[model samples]
Target: MFRTQQSRSGNDLRFSLLILPGLRRAGMVVRLLMCSVLLLALTALSGKFGEAQAAGSTAGKHRAASSGAKGRHRSVRKKAALPAKARTPARGRRHGRAAAVVAGATAATAAAAVAASPAAPAKAITTNTKPELLPRCGFTEASRRHIFSRGVYVLDEETNTPLFERNADTVAPIASVTKLMTAIVWLDQKSLPMANRLEVTEDDLDNLKFTHSRLNVGASLSRADMLHIALMSSENRAAAAMSRDYPGGRPAFIAAMNARAQALGMPHTHFENATGLSPENVSTPRELAELVKAANRYQLIRNDSLDKQKIINIGRGQLQYINSNRLIRYGQVNATVQKTGFINESGHNMVLRLLVHDRRPVIVTMLGSGTADGSRLDGVRIAKWLNCSLN
Candidate 1:
């Protein structure tokens, strides 16, 4: 019985030893798994933090660029608002170039960031309040070299060759130069006798520009006298009266003016009214040169336009109308055909057909002079140039 009890105790002791080693090994495996899970959690949190930091940095850069562009735009506006006397041109130009460069860089970076995001609204950047100023007239730098007038053209009447040209193709208001055409159209109708007396009425008053005329309403004059005054003095009333006296009235006269212009190869020329009070009466310098050539064919236009003064009897009084062209009255040029015109839109305009050397006929037309004297000076300069060329 004692031997049997000792064997059972030994068997229990061996089983206990084996179970303890297996329990220790299982604990070590469980601890290793827990450590690995903790490490994975820490690594995941660090990666998420890095991503958030990068997104925040990108957003901050975008905001900074947007604000910078806005600041530049405000600065440019302030500079433009400065008084002309206060601003130095050299400094202004430098700042302008710098602003342009900064603006371009900001726009490119912002565009790149926007393309990456695609959900953000794009901000507009403005650089200046007023755009850059550009030249209004003259085709080439050489053509605009010395000419102050907006448009200038010199043509040799004999050969119809353009001697000099500046903004010659630009169509603009011609003012009372339309009268030359009016005289031509009026005389074209041989049936309409010049001896027939035409009375100035309220309809003849310039309603478009409210211009003054010495030929008062209700004054009576022959058709020939109306043409004479219109061509010589740029009398708006006389031209309007003649247009009203046409077979089909003012509308027909206007149509005839346009038709005559078309026939004369003046495709860009248009006439809204005979008196040239309307700004719609437009012609190019080249086209007007052709017009001068055509009007020179009329002997009466040549006779009346060159006259310095005309004393006409009107209602028991004689009103002597002086020629409007200072170039003619002052003997500045021996103009065969000369007409001067002015309006707010057309400026001081003049067309002249004059003998330059001995008998070399040349036509000079200038438009957009600031003053009457300016127009006269332009004509004088052109005449001198022509004389030099002829010699």
Candidate 2:
């Protein structure tokens, strides 16, 4: 029995040893599996972290690029807001182009305006240095209608004022009105007697003008009668005879006339004869007014000139002479002194010391009338105008 027991124990030991080796192998395999599982989980976690870091880096780069772009846009805006002097070269180029366009448009508009508009007379040259002689007045136009004489002068005798005048300085023939000066020169001779009879001869005949004479060649008359006929009738024979009978004869009488005219400021007067038959017998209206004023101082001249009619008895027959002035003959005007004259070259002429309202003496002289009664009509018009305008 003992022997069988020992053999069984040895077999049990062998079986135990084999079982230990197999159990050791199974424990090693389980520990290796657990380590591999833990390594796999750790690797998956590291991959997820790496992916998160890459995504964050890419997002940061995009944000930085967007911010840089905005800053550049702001810088460009700031430069654009500067003034032209402070502007960059690029901005100056833009402004220069715009100014060029405006200048071209302005030039074109000015050229069009100049092309749309019309063109301007020439003047005469004169060398006349004489000062104007016509009186300056506001009523020149109105007074022109009231006067018909080519030469006219109206003066206020009392005040020695000029009322109206036209061409008064024009030199013209005096015609029979020359007798006024002749009468003045004759009367100035105090030695000449009024009752001295003077014989009419062939020299008294009007040889130049060839005018008719009522007094015959052999007729005789006193100085008073001769003077009366000469002044009243404007008889050429009577005037010639009186000049011949003067103290120094015809030459002396003519000299006295010119001297008297010069003394009276008659600058434009020249007398060739006493009868005013010659065309050379010239005087201006301004000068003739002075002659009238001087002659009016004589009572004989004033009476004879204003006389309507007078009867003179010579040896042959009874003769009647009438004043030539129609104004005095018809009593149409209260003229204190007057004379009438007519010649082809001188035209109709008249001078009068007209008494307005029987008080004021207005001297009016007219020359170069176109019509026979033109001077008379002018006198009437002057009277009417003075009455209407002044009164």
Candidate 3:
């Protein structure tokens, strides 16, 4: 069908030429035929040239490879080629150099990244054995919710080593735990007549507001009565009275407390107030245990601390104050002395010295208890756990 159409076109052109106004009809026909032949030759030549160009470009980009060809020392053919529409740029002749620069840049980046990272040990050190976790201490299976603190601790009356421990060095307020220390220092410093006519004054009542004590104003009380109320009931006024009665008043009392803590080797402990009102008044469970041990050395602190019940006749007459620390009657161990402390900032804090199964005195301190019962339970739990596990 295509050949038929071409034949028809040629016939029309030939017929048109035959009728054209010209020097002669035959001559005009011959001239038209010659012109058509020349056009055909030119079209064929253009097609061949285009095909050769396309083939060359598809072979590869031209590179100036050194070689001997023909008569010239270096034969330069139109070796580098491009598509008919796209011409090659001279700058791209240095492709190898450009690639080298990029390779170097990548290597440098890798090296910099490696250098910036933490270095592994030079030796190919390796271990395949299972690691040893510390032996479980203090109530190992006890639920964490039942614990009074965020840390782990172990109490053994026989072995001074912690049966268990976790972050035991952190310092925190001792709360009424401060009173035991106060009583210890008092017993040591004041040799004034045991009945030195100690009186609870206005300042003592005023200080009770911050201490959570129930001591009323205008209550006349003796030194011994104040000590019992303070140690057993955690009365702030009683503690304050003791602090103010020191040789140099409260500041002197605080200095003595700090001095005594340092002397006791409680390196991280500090006392800003005698009644433990300030959250800044802090110590470690480890240090508190030390303080409890030291406190037990004194007769008054040990006796009052061990008592589970007490009845004092203050100015109010026939006043009764129950022992705040309940571990004394827990029956886990015979507690020689114990004190309990609680505040929003300190939670429930308690310390106790007890006669253990082997007759060794074990002292324990626990902090951040969940409830009022927490401190007492912590002491009994530790004691019980120690007997079962450590022994």
The alpha-carbon lDDT assigned to residue 365 of candidate 3 equals 70
lDDT of 3: 0.69
Question: What's the lDDT for candidate 1?
Answer: 0.82
Q: Candidate 2's residue-wise lDDT over 250-368, tens digit each?
A: 99999999999999989889998888898899999888999999999999999877778888867777788888877778777878788888889999999888886678777889999
Residue 218, candidate 2: how far off, in angstroms? Answer: 0.8
Model 2 scores what on Cα lDDT?
Answer: 0.80
Q: Write one digit per residue (lDDT tens) for candidate 1, span 244-363.
A: 999899999999999999999999999999988788999998899889988999999999999899988776588899899888888889778988888999999999998977698988
Query: Can you give the TM-score per candidate against the true fold?
Result: 0.63, 0.63, 0.60
Model 1 residue 356 CA deviation in Å: 1.5
Residues 162-184, candidate 3: write the lDDT tens digits.
Answer: 55454568877778789878888
Q: Which sections of candidate 1 miss by over 4 Å?
A: 1-146
lDDT rank order? 1, 2, 3
Clashes of 1: 0
